[model samples]
Target: MNINNAYVIAKKEFGFNIKNHWFLLSSVIFCFLNFIIIYFGEIISGDYSQTDIRSLSLSIIHLQMYLIPLFSFILSYDAILSERESGVLDLILSYRVTLLEVMFGKLLGNCIVFTISFLLGFLPVFLYLYFLGIKFLVLFKFVLVSIWLSFIFNSFALYVSNSSKDRTFVILLSIFIWLFFIFVYDIIFTFFVVLFYGSISNYFLNFLLFFNPAEMFRLISIFYFIPNDITDLFGINVSSFNNFYVCLSMFIWVVFVFFSFLFFYFEKK
Candidate 1:
């Protein structure tokens, strides 16, 4: 594991993403959405005399649940397979770097791109919230959770990228996985709860929630930031587990999928 080789590859990948406009495009989209959210929040506050920080944060969380997964998938779905198909993987492997180092470098590069875009997009909103007298702690927590959510999905997408040699198949699979996790999972959970009702234990439901990063993120935000009424409105029973458990579960999900990606990636090599 030549750390210097890895760093060089990571820097190159990160620079390529910026030069190719993916970073700029994502930042612009997210910034526009963040501005709109703040504008709407301002309008609501005008009528209500108060807008809770939690409300704004929850709104962002819900949007993040949908957008982050899609963006992550689109950004990384071709990270590895495209390299292989274009013979870039072979060229890179001829260098001083090991396969593991290359994988780690690519992962790091994507992470850097994502983190920069997220900060650029959300910094203005954070400032606006601060001007509105929202506490720093709440805003900071939201940023942390949002970043972790992106990381989780990016790892999943990279796994998809590494798994398939077919770019078209990888693209389709990425979209399907995003749709399943972001939309279908919630619908299925709701259906089961509605149908079975008391037959399903709350623990079992929370267990299911823990498995889907998107739902887990929503539940975490609901418990941490949003009011109880919102959960009640959706018939969601807030889990008894602490935020630490949810964070750990998400971290574990990222690590598990990432290593699985690395294992398959090297196996093919």
Candidate 2:
């Protein structure tokens, strides 16, 4: 791999991303929306109590879940296919940069841009929580999980973009995958649990929880706010398991999806 060329590509992409007016405008709008929603909700209900704070925080968490995937998909869905369609792929290929370098550089650029956008949206929400007397550790964990989840979504988007030639197909596929994990998966899981009813064992639910990212995020967020007894009823024991395991799983998912992209790029090159 040509490290210098890779760096050059990454720097160019980063510069373009920084100058992109649409992205900057969107980030500002999202931050304003977050502030408006939370502030208005509190004002109208006249309930700035602890319960309201927790509900607002969880709503912000849900917003992150929705926006992160959308931002990552929009950034990555055209990474390679656009170049290929424009006939610039041949020129880039002739520049002595390895496919690995190009792919890695593109992935890095997208991750950085999307991460910044995600953080921008979180800043207002963070300040709101702080003013509400939320614990520093609780706020910190929410930001950490938001960034980590953004990384996971970035990897997933890059993998999908690399695997497909049509940009439209890539976008659609990313949306489908997000919807599957975010909404459909849990609904399906609930259906199975209800169908089995008393016949289903504890182990099956545990197994389901292990692979469900949406559930994992919700469990962690709830554990941060609620009592242990309530969390137990939710079927997640955040304190029982090591936190490192969750971080490791997220890291592994990022690396796994990244390698999958590399494998597809090389196999088809």
Assess each prediction's global lDDT (C-alpha) against the native. 0.78, 0.69
lDDT per residue (tens digit) for residues 101-129 in model 2? 77778877776776677577667767767
Model 2 error, position 174 (Å): 2.4
| Pairs with steric clashes in candidate 2 | none
* TM-score of candidate 1 against the unseen true structure: 0.88
Worst lDDT run of 10 residues, candidate 1, spans: 225-234
List the pairs of residues colliding in candidate 1.
none
Show the lowest summed lDDT stretch of 10 residues, model 2: 229-238
TM, every model: 0.88, 0.84
Best by TM-score: 1
